[model samples]
Target: MRCPYCGSQDSQVKDSRPAEDGGAIRRRRVCPDCGGRFTTFERVQLRELTVTKKSGKRVPFDRDKLARSVETALRKRPVEAERVERLINGIVRRLEQSGEAEIPSEEIGSMVMEALKGLDDVAYVRFASVYRDFREARDFETVIGELSRPARSAPDDGA
Candidate 1:
């Protein structure tokens, strides 16, 4: 590796360790010419994944965009960033594991809604209303009702 201080091409690794997240390798290197020490992070490069829209248009799959949409729906709420990040990571992992190079936009939207639904009801409704394209007030009310209703334990539960 080239040294940033003296632009020396010769460098030796003094120490190697795994990053805190354990996703990459952190290396301590020293330039032979200038004796400058630097740190470098190395990680595996994965193939780029693309998402195919319903209209046959293909675009690169972006996890950050998905997370941003979720964050927007959850704005001003008590939820923290780590929880939202974990939720987004879960959804992204599912998509990546599906082995499909291209995923539909609708599927991604639904996945985000499902993830939010489990995290926060208000956020879920907000995301769902926009995602499902609620055209009337009744649609929103119906979703709210569904969310408000308590879960029935038995098939014979009658109220």
Candidate 2:
């Protein structure tokens, strides 16, 4: 790795460890030329994912874009950055586990909605408003009503 302090091509790794979330490798390096130290992080890219939009356009799946959407909904909310990161990771992992090279944009929106719903109800409604393209206040009311309902359990069946 090139040293940022002196632009030296020669560097030695002083220490290496897994990052906080275990999603990346953190390396502490020293530049021989400048006698400077720096840190680097490495992450693995399993595969490229494509997102199929409603207009029939296919684009590479962008984690930043997904984060921005979620963050926008979470703006002014009490959700923490770590929680958001975890939520994004969970969503991406689910998409990857589906074993599909291409995924519909609607599916991505639904996944975000589900994640937000569990994290924060206000954020969930905010995301649903934009994602579902709410045309009137009634749309919000409908979703709120649905969320307020108690989950129904299946009837017991004797074996």
For residues 1-159, write the lDDT of model 1, one tens digit per residue.
999999988899999998635646999999989889999977543556788887899999877698789998999889988687678767777887788877889999988877787788889888988888899999989888767665444564565
lDDT by residue (tens digit), candidate 2, 34-146: 99999997866577899999999999999889999999999999988989989998898899888998999999999998899889999999999999999999999998986
Model 1 CA lDDT for position 56: 93
- In terms of lDDT, the poorest run of 10 residues in model 1 is 150-159
Best by lDDT: 2
All candidates' lDDT scores? 0.82, 0.90
Highest TM-score against the true fold, candidate: 2
**Candidate 2 at 76: error in angstroms?**
1.2
Model 1 residue 4 lDDT?
A: 95
TM-score against truth, every candidate:
0.66, 0.74
Please give the TM-score that candidate 1 achieves against the real structure. Answer: 0.66
Candidate 1 achieves a global lDDT of 0.82
Model 1: number of clashes?
A: 0
For candidate 2, report its TM-score.
0.74
